[model samples]
Target: MENNFKMVAKTLFGFEELLAKELKQLGAQAVTIGVRHVSFVGDKGFMYKANLGLRTAIKILKPIAKFKVINENDLYNKVNAIPWENYLKSDGSLAVGATLNGDTFTHSQYVSLKTKDAIVDRFRDQTGERPNVDLRFPDLKIDIHIDRHFCTVSLDSSGESLHKRGYKIATNIAPINEVLAAGLIMLSGWDGQSDFMDPMCGSGTVLIEAAMIACNIPPNLMRNEFGFERWGDWDVDLFEKIEESLLSKTRDFHHKIMGFDKSPSAVEKATQNVENAKLEDFIYIKHEDFFKTQKGGEEHLHMVFNPPYGERLDIEMETFYSSIGSTLKHKYPGTNAWMISSNLEALKHVGLRPSRKIKLFNAKLEARFSKYEMYAGTKKTHKLEAKND
Candidate 1:
């Protein structure tokens, strides 16, 4: 238990609970949810597992020190006191990023620069050598979080954001973030129990994530690298053991996972991504206009997608959203459809009242994730109309 240390998994807004649930399911101890992040206690091997397995996490951080700082000099002193050699080599490259919440630090960039200077100064003073700064690919990635007078310095365990799962070499114009796609699927309550789909799937993110979730596949198994891989204490055998343990728990998913994109190019890219992920057997991608498609059978379908909300005009977007609503209403019965869009005005054109709506963000844009449940039969459709009437 002495080896167990606290770690934080950062996620998107509205995904804190999902990330916490993922950490708990992955055998984390003392899991607790915070704003856009989850704190958990785990050992080194468990930390590796958390980085590799969590679907909703954007990055995982291992806090090394937390102290109160009243000024920039105090910040430098606190950061410099930590043993930098323990995490990085004299010849290694490092990067520092900071997030400031209090008025004490008005500029996060300045804070990052100060932290970097402290680490480099320490190394230079002790060994006459210092790690160079490499923001793109660093041997050590440090994160500083300051809330009011409290400052927390942590080492980033996952690099390049967990959303870059390395399987998507090709993408559509507006491919959804892999983390957001997975979170949306989780929020939809789809556990690979029935047929799943992304009706407007672009580049197959949702499809691949669905397949991975259904089969218990570790999300970052295909990632090119993790920040810990470059650490001074990096252990290859321990990491391999954790990976094997995760692979051993993968369950078989029987239900079909399908994707539809109107654009042939998008479908091709999606298919390529699915193949890249080695999930082609579990996923099927088609270049068909979703508006024209109907439910293939009597089986219930679970759909999650993000429709286009780009530079199109209001009337066109309204028509598109209305078509989406109409397609689900008449053609796709016995289905639970979920969608996310930043265009609130266009969303009102959908006509059908959403059963549930949750506030979320699609990158920088504020968006709403809404669900529409269609009843099973023609009678239910008439009943729905009657209720609306």
Candidate 2:
């Protein structure tokens, strides 16, 4: 137990509970949810596993020190007091990034500069050399958080945001974030038991994420690097063992996973990305207007998509939303459709009451994720008319 240390996995808004559940399911101990993060205790190997396995996590941070500071000078002193030599060599490169949530720190950039100066000064004074700042690639990536007078310094274990997943080589206009896509799929409660689809697949992010979840695949297996790989005490054998352990748990996915887009360019890009992820066998992308399509099978279908919202004129968007409602209501029976949109007014034109609506964010814009359940037989028409009324 002594070997276990507290780590925080940062996530997007409205995803704290989902990320917490993911960590707990991954065998984390003492899991607790924070505003946009989940803190837990895990050993170094678990850290590697979390980075590879957690579909909802943005980045994992290991807290190195926490202290109280009233002024900038106090911040410099406390940061300088940390044993940076143990984490980085004098010749190594480093980067410091900060987030401030209180009055004491007015500018996050200024805070990052102060922290970087302290570390560089310490190394220069003790070893006659200092690590240079490298934002793109660093030997050690440090994170600083200042809440009022409380300060926490942490080491970033995942080099890039986990959303990069390294599977996407091409992107279309306004492609969905991979982390958000995975979280949305999880929230929708799709488990590979039924056929899955993303009608407006764009670059096929959702379809890929759904297949990964269904197959129990590690999300970051395709990633080229992690922050821990460059740490001073990096252990190659331990990391490889953790990776193999996660890979061994991957299971077979039998159901169909498909995507559709009106644009031929989008279909091409999506196909390329699916091949890059080596999931082409499990995923199929087709160029077709989703509005013109019907359910291909009699079995229940689970759908999640991000439709165009407000990009066109108001009248056009309203018609588009209404067509979506009409298509699902009349054509796609025995299906459950979920969509996320920032256009609340356009969503109203859909003409069917959402059985469930959850507030979320698409980047900086406040959005809504809603669900529509279409049943089989005559009940479908009756329920659709009732919701419309």
Those runs of model 1 whose alpha carbons end farther than 4 Å from true positions after fitting are 311-315, 378-389
Q: Lowest lDDT 10-mer window, candidate 2?
A: 308-317
Q: How accurate is candidate 2 locally (lDDT)?
A: 0.93
Leading candidate by TM-score: 2
lDDT score of residue 83 within candidate 1: 90
Q: Report the C-alpha lDDT of model 2 over 1-389, residue by residue, as the tens digit.
A: 88999999999998999999999999999999999899999999999999999999999999999999999999999999999998999999999899998887889989999999999999999989999999999999999988899999999999889999999999987888999999999989898899999999999999999999999999999999999999977789999999898889999988999999999999999999999999998998999998899997799999999998775424488889999999998889989999999999989999988899999988888999999988877776867987999
Candidate 2 lDDT score at position 187: 88
Alpha-carbon shift of residue 239 in model 2 (angstroms): 1.1
lDDT of candidates 1 onward, in order: 0.92, 0.93
Q: Model 2: residues >4 Å from true position, as ranges?
A: 311-315, 378-389
- lDDT, candidate 1, 1-389, per-residue tens: 99999999999999999998888888899999899899999999999999999999999999999999998999999899999888888899999999999888989999999999999999999999999999999999999999999999999999889999999989876779999999999999998999999998889999999999999999999988999998878899999999999999999998999999888999889989999999999998888999889999999999999999854423378889999999999999889999999999989999889999999999889999999998876756768888999
The residue pairs found clashing in candidate 2 are: 159-227
